[model samples]
Target: MRRSMWRVMGLFSKKRQQSPSGSTSGQSCAATSTTSAYELQEKDLGRLHRAAAHGNLAWLRRWHWWLKRVSINRRDKEKRTPLHLACANGHADVVSFLVQENCQLNLTDNFKRSPLMKAVQCQQEKCVAILLEHGADPNLADADGNTALHLAVLSPNTAVAGLLLEHNANIDAQNQEGYTPLNLAVSKHHKEMVEFLQKKGADGHAQDQRERTALMVATFAEDMNAIQLLLWHGADSLIGI
Candidate 1:
């Protein structure tokens, strides 16, 4: 009787193991058809980005539904929709389509950098123009209060700064550290940008909590040109000291 019970228990265990395996496989299969609520991985996302950048209608045709879902999904840690990636890579048509689909206009990444910021940071002038046409805010800042103007200021390109200014970006905007775009130019000793920001209303007198104005910052490594430019721009010699 004991032997007979052992045999019966063995059969039951075997059947239970097989049942669970079959159930799990069916669930996975069901999930695939149930629509992927998951955000694409970086690799998968890269594929979409490449396709959008090229404006390959055929590639888009093959992945349109999936791409659309990604463009609208706000579930990622970065909070970036497909438009953000496309804009960063300068995909004009992709940007237009997403706007038509009503993708979130101001989605920010982990750094509080918006799609518009990405476009500007990468110096994608055409994409920037498209975003502006789609109503992207020229003054949108990162988490640190660094606006698109701030980004342009950080970069060495005066043209990017000029483009942003022409789009009505605030020249006097300060970061969390209170460093205005002019301050950044001075800190980096970017002479042309310093001139441009000053002409565009960048306040050279702006300072951080450490009492460092752009002029004071220019004093860091013996930059006479930046000092002269800041002075020429009306920077107070003792303002931040």
Candidate 2:
């Protein structure tokens, strides 16, 4: 009787082990299927982004009707849409078409930079104008709180800066560091930009987070030309030590 009981117990243990193993295999297969589906979706989105960035207008037009199905505004892992890539790469035609398709004009990327900011960063003059003409916001700041005008001044692109100013970008816009466009120009010793910002009504007397004025910053850098321009603009030297 004892021998008979042992044989029954062994049979039960073996059946239990086999059932669990089969279930685990099925689960693993399901998980792999789910992972593959996600990868395919990412690849589709990446293809769209690459098409825009590379100026493949043919591909874009061929798939124009399918844009709504895949969502033209769908962002990648970095939250950058096709419009962002097109603007950054200076694809004016792509940008124009995308704009006509009613793509979000002010959609920001992961870094909170709008399409206009990307255009300015890449110095795409025509792309910048196209975006501005379609009413892209010039005052949207990036993750660093630097607006398109701030980047233009840093780039020393007087034409881009002028365009942004004409569109009502804040002349005295301050970044996260409280440094205005003029302050940035002064620090970078961009004489032309400093003059342009001052003419556009950028506050020469604006103080940074550390209470340092443009004139004070120029003085510290010992930039005679910057000092002269600031003084001419009536930048207060006594304040912001």
Please report, in order, the local distance difference test score of every candidate based on alpha carbons. 0.64, 0.74
TM-score per candidate: 0.71, 0.79
TM-score of 2: 0.79
- Steric overlap count per candidate: 0, 0
Model 2 over residues 112-225: C-alpha lDDT tens digits?
A: 888898888878999999999989999987887889888887677999999998898898888887888888887777899988888888887777776767765665555667
Query: Which candidate wins on lDDT?
Result: 2
Candidate 1 lDDT over residue span 1-241, tens digit each: 3443234334434434544442221112111121112233555455655565455547766776886666453424456666777777677777777677677778787777788788777677777777777788888877767788777665566776777777788888767767777776766667898888788777776775456667655554346677667666555444321
